[model samples]
Target: MTFKELKHFLGEINVKVDDLYAEKLFNECDTSHSKTLEGSEIEEFYKRLTYRNEIEVIYSKYASSKGKMSVEDLGNFLRMEQREDVGLNEAVALIQKYELDEAAKEKKLMSRDGFLMYLQSSDGLVLNPTHTLVYQDMSQPLNHYFISSSHNTYLMEDQLKGPSSTEAYVRALTKGCRCVELDCWDGPNGDPVIYHGYTLTSKILFKDVIRTVKEYAFKNSEYPVVLSLETHCSMDQQKVMAHHMKTILGSMLLTAPLGGKMPTHFPSPEQLKGKILVKGKKLQSREHSMTSPESLQGEEEESVSEEDEAADLPEEKGMPKKSKLKLARELSDLVVFCKSVHFPGFETARETQAFYEMSSFGESKAFKLAQESANRFVIHNTRQLSRTYPRGTRTDSSNYNPVDLWNAGCQIVALNFQTSDKSMDLNQGKFQQNGFSGYILKPRFMRDGQTQFNPTSIMQGEWLTPKKLHVMIISGQQLPKVNKNKNNSIVDPLVRIEISGVPRDVCSAETEHIEDNGFNPSWNKNFQFDICVPELALVRFVVEDHDTASRNDFVAQYTLPFMSLQNGYRHVPLLTKEGNPIASSSIFVHIMVVDQ
Candidate 1:
């Protein structure tokens, strides 16, 4: 993007920019001396503008011209910015705890390198650079954990009339999505196409989608990719899909059983590293009822859309009549691990169980299970994988709350990634921890075969003691600049801290807002919460500009798992709407945890 174009884009996002800074940034990123950024240079330009450089900014405040800061200087800086009552001695101890002092070759001093190391560690507000990939144990069965997934991974906007592109797959995969859906139908020229059938969603070639997946399947992590295929094609087209996937994916496709015998337990991600498994209706085996005619008829009514039904008939003069397709043996062989099926209530599902048989439930069915058969659902998921998807009525591509299903141990709670609403926000926050690897091991109770824990029926009196959480929102440093326009520029910024957990009513906490100054706006206000259960708690910090006439406009926000929180003085780095870290933007706070 050119400097002028970049300025206009920033303006549309309500960001205030000065010409000098814009020109300088453009020049720095313009490697070819072409005045405009090209290729990866454009992404580099945006990163430089949006990504927060928190460590260098903090170090400059305390470091001298000699590029080193004394221990006393570091202690005083921490006292003023983080813990107001931190004694010099205590600050020194905290510094040592974070290993900032050790980075210095000389004793009693912190060098520039030491400050950078501290910022990259768990002690600083920024995310650890290495935390975005696989950092958790992958030895557990795939059925025993929650996997990050996206629904209709091709749609970029409204389901009925939106563009479908390979970029959608690229975005979700880069964000650590493990399971993605592919709705394939026969397209012109004998190639399969992916789109939301029955809607006006634009289509992309199946081969193009597969190519994109091949390039990015293991970019974020080596965990296997689950391709949830919804097929609407003839047997010939099914052969084409199998051939394209085999040739394109090569050895990456899991086409056979792991060993000679059926797997006693699902394979761990480590065992299927860099492989892609297809999930679709397989040809019927006499033992498995999922492929029965009655089951397929019932699922067709639930999964097929009006547009898809219309396509089946010869509506136009040149249009060919769509015929019912069967799963070819070649295609069925690819679904050896996970065979997608319809959920047949609780009783029938329990009687004939197959480890490879995976069933999906829409929002209504899953809600009924949660409300009426919570324990049954939880126990079933412990031994079998269950996928929960948004109801068909959600044409806008909106999402429902995925927590209830997650609480019941559903492995794949798919959401519409194209929408950045609160539902998607919660999904991002849930997977932000545990290395952001698109998979999280289920909690002990959910995995342990003996425990019959119900998320909605937790007894408050069962536990003897409840924990207390204390937090002080000291100040915000280098916050993002927001304004209406040049004439009505500047904003009155404030911070709101939200506490979320299982029961929605107990989630809200009263917090006083800080006013006026965007840079270094300090509230120093303390807030407390009595947590009956800490295992399901989540904390979200939102920075918004307080306005009298309308709702508070958002400036920046950050959310994460409360269990991953760092105690003592800590910085909370913020993320923009694009999910990139903001440069030099963070909220400083002091945290204290007490168990009653």
Candidate 2:
């Protein structure tokens, strides 16, 4: 083929074939030096183009020099490199699983192509199969687990003008979110409705939201779902809301604590599977003793959590000190295991906090507590659940960094799921483990009150086993075009990796961009990170398109817990900005975790 034709052909296919690649192919394949020659040259060009030299080196090293990986060779590689303890039977089974050649399978050998296929398969993905399964101890109390939670679950867009629909609840549920927020207000015709109250956002009926929740609650995960209600309805309307939940949810709704009495510890996710728990203001006899109608109004103001109090308060504009609406007896009765209560100081909470009662904090307050009393916050969480949510000032419905709150052992670090960003990525990554059950057993230090674990003290004492993380970005395959509208605009793709955790462990680094190459870019770049507390650290791999004149545009990313990552040669799936995996798009990588 002529050079002009070759360049056009390269343009059609999504490969990073620049001038260097074109000239080398033309000079070597054009054996006759004819400008317009064709023959085995076409075959020669394609062969050299798709070949991966990095993989070839490993295959050559362990394939008995016979161009095939025998069971023993595969076993040795897994043991030494992948750190997997495999036996003869296991290696044979893997060969059968990955080997496409029938003859090679019968002889218990994996061809080079088969090896590459295996490396690209799910087994080769960075997430370990064990983590994808329900592998953790699930019998611990609910407070001992990190619950996958969402804030403003009904909003499909921005906080002020976004439309609120039941579909939002369905989406969050399907993604294994265990906790969802519902802002209920009085609606027309005595029916209650849900929306961002006092905002321009649209609203949906309360009954419809409950029905949708009932149907999709256990579809993705059988674990319990917590409905965090910020109710503003009058007593009569609140009774109607409770009736709807009772009739629609049936036995799935937990109306009373298990065993019909309060216990020192809450039920485990395993114990409450398929149940929906109501988290709202519950009336205390002391607060409700005043029979007068005027006194009843004060009960709601006192019992509501601090985060809920600021829900409708406009920033700087200030809301009027209206009479606090009373909580209905029926709706309050439905709040079984998760009764929302106002947060007192850390000292007060440690002394008077009940296991069944929980408190929600605005991001600023939660972070302040985490900073001033790291060990105290950890101890408080060991006995009672704490939820940290976005501040009211996030008019755009943005998310706060959850890793910092999570480090303090807050079980429910709620984020706006509709706003996909670094926060949601971290949330998804943390909950993606333990079979995506929406619950993860907390580390022993975080769950044990007597352990004296402090989030900020990891750098001082030898409490945590720090490790050296070595990541080698081998190459990228079929990275999507950032500007999809520009058919001829090829991306100069680069990989940016970040480690987020406590103050000291947070850092990031990037690779040099591959010019005009969104497809088949070989970086072979390596980065090292010293993770002091791997338990709390999150590793994020972000791919971006380089633009010298402007800031780099985001391409794709994947984030996961540092502890959940599998070592050795693995392929990382590239996810879009919305967290959906791009088809046939992945970056090949080599990872090693060494003890410090």
Candidate 3:
């Protein structure tokens, strides 16, 4: 195309151009070229066209360089255009086209900004940002098990029904439960109402229960509740109930487990929407029925051929058969499926060995499998097994612990607790010390008069409290020398102690004067002295403004308990007013005297 035509096309595409250059070219062309131009005029017109074409090529290369340009970059270019009257809508459309091209290069159909941009571009697409799509795997094992007593009050006898179900839920919430289990059965009118039994007398409207709970949560923002719905009825009934819950509550529905004899609650993958979780039964290894004589003979013959092949190998190549068996056992268990697979604890002859052996499979393998399958691996371990395999140990020779399962590929650790008290503390000291976050306390031994194996109580006190001390002592070496600057010498040395303790009043600080004016300049003012005495123990006090030359020093004293052993111990606020101790900050001085 000619230079003028090309410039017009560029303007239509929202490409900015210099106004002065366009004006100069247009003026020259209008003056020289007639309707039918001669050879020299035509040649000049072609030269101008060539120059404009070169500029267009360079501009196009810069704009489409990476197959995509940021909206900010495009916006900046548009804003700097000589054409001040360009339409904003046209500019945005052009920018979006470029962004789409970039998204294509990244193999993503939509860029992170694409959704927001699209929403702003048009109001037709009703995109709900709050609602998230969650897929359910029917074949996967349940990582978490929830039990709800919502219908227990109605089902049980009048004598048995003591506290209301709502009160029980509040108690559970206070004890720090992330998941609550509820059983739902088919009520009259095909509506799935929540109940623990098959009878109608036990049933309570699931909609009513959910509405009440949701209202409670709205009033209390801190409370986070995830419902684990157990479908006691048929798959079709469960599906109908799920639909009703979704219609009523919308996105507040957390996760529901599809349960039945031959379970099939979620119809298609699409219908299995929302945070739907499937609980698979734990599979146990069972003994195979004995084969006929002929079948046994065939198996023996195949084994013999394998042994013959092994015998032909060189001595160096052939390792011990036992070692080979061990290696095979380890590798076989490490086999991970790309799709969801119900993983019960290893139940082979090498079950114990497999538990320890499988630990070698690093986090990368575990994470890769989890991502590839798009399913979380639920690891089931009893309290006994967890205690055996304590966390942080390598699989080679380390014992099994609940934390170890977590450290391994297991995304969820399921532990069975049998205790009246809900507070469960695993007492993994190192975990508490290192601050590695994990789920509920596994099982542990509780001692009344003697140690006993029981379902450990979840109601336990804080395991550990971090003690932080920041004692700002005046540098003995920084003391003013006789020959050094004397104007900045220490005067009226003041020390302030700040201590944080549990219960706030557990620890107090009291300062005592060990020896007033004990240090002499003649003995070298820079020399460090042991100012701390037994009476001053546990008190972190800072010394300031010591006037060594005048032999006049003020020692502010405070004493605190040697140790504070309470849950949630922290740095307590030190009561200080203008660098001096207040009466509230004072603790009685108890000088422990010892004969020298």
Candidate 4:
């Protein structure tokens, strides 16, 4: 019988089907009939049956006792009928006549799978089998794969070859990392240079760095390398450095944001033809706008009058101008050349903080500002926010978890491994548990002492080892497994059995058979034997042959219903001649219950 049919039948009779009682019912029903019924047929019979009087009695009893009947309690009632010599057909008829009001009660105890199906059909919360809410984000399109740092096999320091630092650029390109971040500063000659430090000693000509990256990409099929040129130089020098990057790298280099605009001055489509991506303005909140009362007066006036007077104001005065000098057309044209933008120093925690700080305004103005940006917001140091955010804090009141951050609006949250933040750890755990996809640690974070500029950390530290990071990621999912065992109540959940004793030649063949089938078998007495059992409702075991092959066999199946009061685990004695007790299998059965 279908599980639903069987459940329906039990429901009509004012009886419940629980793990243990369900197993008992299955055994009894199967034994009573010539052939086992399909799970569906069993369920259908109960669903069609009507129970009027029995339901009233059940309801009256529940009312008197101020208690509701559970699936197990219903099973117990059926068990009592069996003990009293009640025929299945007659009992079903009686139940159909009396018990009809318990359908809602049964729903509360559905298995996880069943419950999930109900949720999907009833509430429209489409969830995967793994229990993750499914939705889509328009701004961040899903990419098939991402390039990451090969930290397990390579080190960044090893790439710093010669005064050119070209080797560092080469190493990243050769590894197929489409994106590379380079630290830049002003040199003694007032030129922008590639370096990871704020001082000139670490600087290398910006042109050389771009040339090396371009050469590597050309040799490797024009692979896109998003070179993040972080500048610790004067604004004018930074703009000059951006120009040099465009000259040498052409379409192969990415320019950092310069005064709310992209670096490369692409006046025409020809300038953008083969160049690398250029990042435009950083995603910021409306709060970041530095509008003086003087600038606001004209905008406020424009709302009152729709005339050309509002348009008469100089565009420069109407809009906030770039703080440093760079051709206005160059800034505007570069925007058209850019492929995607990056938000440096934008933190999710900071955004969340901003949300609460603006909560008094009812809606978040910062969030609105981010939404207005056409590009994605790459949040840096998200791990810090995930780790340190108070779990039950008032400002954090939302069903949306950390994995929902990207869907909520932020594109990617970048994590730096060298920085120690509990929020990042927690966020990573949530990501794995929910199966959300996003970026991971790349070369920039893997380089030694790269954490200094990582806003979360004030000091530079040695690069985090790959092994430690992998372990952290793996362990994030380990707690669920551990909890399963720690919460198990069933005692004597496993019993080990050894099979042996056959003619030498026969035994050898049996051993070979086991080995060929990947079953593990071992010797015990003189009679060669294997384990077998009838399928039970409440328990499931992961069995393997103890002989050479380690092939799995059905050692035992419980005949009892599941009792939450009892541990989830259960044990049964091994059988020998004539259903007699013998040794049992040592395998443990991990039961997963689903109700629908």
Tens digits of lDDT, candidate 3, 1-596: 34566455334322224667755555576554443334665566545643323223323443543533344434443344211233555446655453355644254233323422432231111111111111112222222111111112112222112222444344333333333444555678876676433222345676666555555433322323434333444445655655655666665543322231122211222233233222211111100101122432322111001111122223444344421111111111111111112223334312432221112122333334333421122222221111111121221112222322332224222221111111122212111211111122211111111222111111222212223332322111111112123332222223334332112212323233222211210111111112111111233333333444664333233223223111110111122212222331211111111122
Q: Is candidate 2 or candidate 4 better by TM-score?
A: 2
Cα lDDT of candidate 2 equals: 0.85
lDDT of 1: 0.73
Residue 428 of candidate 3: its Cα lDDT? 20
> What TM-score does structure 2 among the candidates reach?
0.91
Cα RMSD (Å) per model? 9.2, 4.1, 30.4, 24.4
**Model 4's TM-score against the true structure:** 0.27
Model 1: weakest 10-residue lDDT segment is: 300-309
Model 1 quality (TM-score): 0.77
> Model 1, stretches more than 4 Å misplaced?
1-105, 111-122, 126-135, 286-325, 460-465, 483-486, 504-506
Q: Encode model 1's per-residue lDDT on 1-596: one tens digit a residue.
A: 77788877665543555689878888988889987888889888766754434445667787763676667777766665543455667546545655444545335567666665465455565333344555668899988878999988998888779999999999999988999999898888899999877667899999999999999999987888999888886677878898899999999998776764456789998788888999877765521332343544332112221122133223546655654556665677678778766666667877876778888877878888976777788888988888888877787888998777887889899988988765676678778876777888777777876566766776543322367878887767667766545544445667777776655314654345555456556677788877665666667778887778889777887877666665555788887765668886788776766787
TM-score of each: 0.77, 0.91, 0.25, 0.27
lDDT of 2 by residue, 154-258 (tens): 999988899998999998998889999989889999999998876789999999999999999999899999999988788789999999999999999998667
Instruction: List the candidate numbers ranked by TM-score, top first.
Output: 2, 1, 4, 3
State each model's CA lDDT, in order. Answer: 0.73, 0.85, 0.29, 0.29
